[model samples]
Target: MGHGGQRDPSEYRKITAEVFYDISRRKNGVRPCPGQGFPTDIKIECSKEIRDYPVGTKVRLDVVETDKEGSRPFLYSSYKWEHEVVE
Candidate 1:
């Protein structure tokens, strides 16, 4: 599971990807967080910028020791805060 929160939309990087499917669980008992609405899972395929990689070649996904370029994505937090006040 991965989640990211950014203050600026431009802080997010844009990449080219081939979308496979987009699934929305709104009608399937999916509950929305206070600020965020319903959730949707989108599947996509993208090519990594591996040096010397041949075009149209398929490679197995595996873990690497280090990432020189910002290819891999990491999620620092998954919690969403909703404030309620009682008077």
Candidate 2:
């Protein structure tokens, strides 16, 4: 049996940068399930210029699951950053 609950691949999800950071960085070296041991400096692959978005810039991401599985199922098979709209 799998370690964690299995999820449907067709079911996609969106998450904000804040949520990503919250899951990525945790106190006492304790991380949330599924994303345990996730890399801090993740290099996002996108055609859009990454430099356009400065640090601390809030952004949304659309992610999906991959065939890779480690301590937990990887949910970053591919993703695209949503463009931030200026007021």
Candidate 3:
């Protein structure tokens, strides 16, 4: 797993990786020490046979950028699993 945060709003940041997974889980672990365990943000609820993919599968992510109104304008990004790669 990787961890990152917004450093600037106007610049573009790149995340380089060789492989991607079809399933993923996100958790917020930014609290102070002695905090609660990692709370799940997303997970597949169905049985593995209904919705399962081979491990180490490459997946495509759909990213959306939006502007938030505040004292200072900030860019926010949201990502989702768009599709699985055939090759």
Which one wins on TM-score?
2
lDDT comparison, 2 vs 3, better candidate? 2
Ranking by lDDT: 2, 3, 1
The CA lDDT of each predicted structure is 0.24, 0.36, 0.26
Against the true structure, what is every candidate's RMSD? 17.7, 10.3, 12.6
Q: For candidate 1, give the lDDT of residue 30.
A: 14
Return the clash pairs for model 2, or none: none
Best by lDDT: 2
- Per-residue alpha-carbon lDDT of candidate 1 for residues 1-87, written as tens digits (9 for 90 to 100): 122343444333322221121235221111112222212222222222321233222222211122226554321111232112111
lDDT of prediction 2? 0.36
Better model by lDDT: candidate 1 vs candidate 3: 3
Q: Which stretch of 10 consecutive residues in model 1 shows the poorest summed lDDT?
A: 25-34
Model 2 CA deviation exceeding 4 Å by range: 1-9, 18-48, 67-87
Model 2 misses residue 7 by how many Å? 11
Task: Estimate the TM-score of every prediction.
Answer: 0.17, 0.34, 0.21
lDDT tens readout by residue for model 2, 1-87: 112335573454544332222245341121112342334333333323323444344444544444443544444423233433221
* Deviating ranges (above 4 Å) for candidate 1: 1-6, 21-87
